[model samples]
Target: MTFANVGTLGTKPGKRDEVVAILTRRNPQLESAGCLLYEVGTNDDEPDTVFVAELWTSAEAHQASLSLDTVREAIAEAMPLLSGQMGGDRFTVAGSPLRG
Candidate 1:
């Protein structure tokens, strides 16, 4: 089943942009690493937050992505910018932009 993992990152007062930059650069690599869809977004109402949306071919593929060198590096770089606990919701794909 397709795995949809959506998450939000709350960064330190001035660190949101940097966190987003790192994630933005890494997103394309995720697609190369078996992610069916990958996106990084921000919320205007929440300036310190970065939103992540990902679609993987399977749960294993999502797990494998965490082990990828580039992904590991990105995580390390983004970790310090995190100011609060990461929050997320997982879903099974019943409908999506990719379904067509």
Candidate 2:
């Protein structure tokens, strides 16, 4: 089953852009780690928040990706820029027309 994760990260007042930058940086390891889709976005009305959507081969793959050195480093870099506020949804995708 495809594991999907969609979330929002609230950044310190004006740090949304920085967080987005960190999240969007190219990480080929993600593909090797089983990431199928990874997107970072923002809402104009939410100036301090960054949104992310990700699809992985499985829930375990998603969790394991966090242990990648580059991923860990990115998290370390973005942590201080965040406000510690986060929200998200995770689910096992039943099917997708795009996949077929």
lDDT of 2 by residue, 8-96 (tens): 99999989999999999999999999999999999999999999999999999999999999999999999999999999999999998
TM-score of each: 0.88, 0.97
Residue pairs in clash, model 2? none
TM-score of 1: 0.88
- lDDT of the candidates, in the order given: 0.87, 0.96
**Which residue segments of model 1 deviate by more than 4 Å?**
26-29, 97-100
Top candidate when judged by TM-score against the true structure:
2
As a whole number from 0 to 100, the lDDT of residue 87 in candidate 2 is 99
- By how many angstroms RMSD does model 2 differ from the true structure? 0.6
Model 2 misplaced stretches (Cα beyond 4 Å): none
lDDT of 1: 0.87
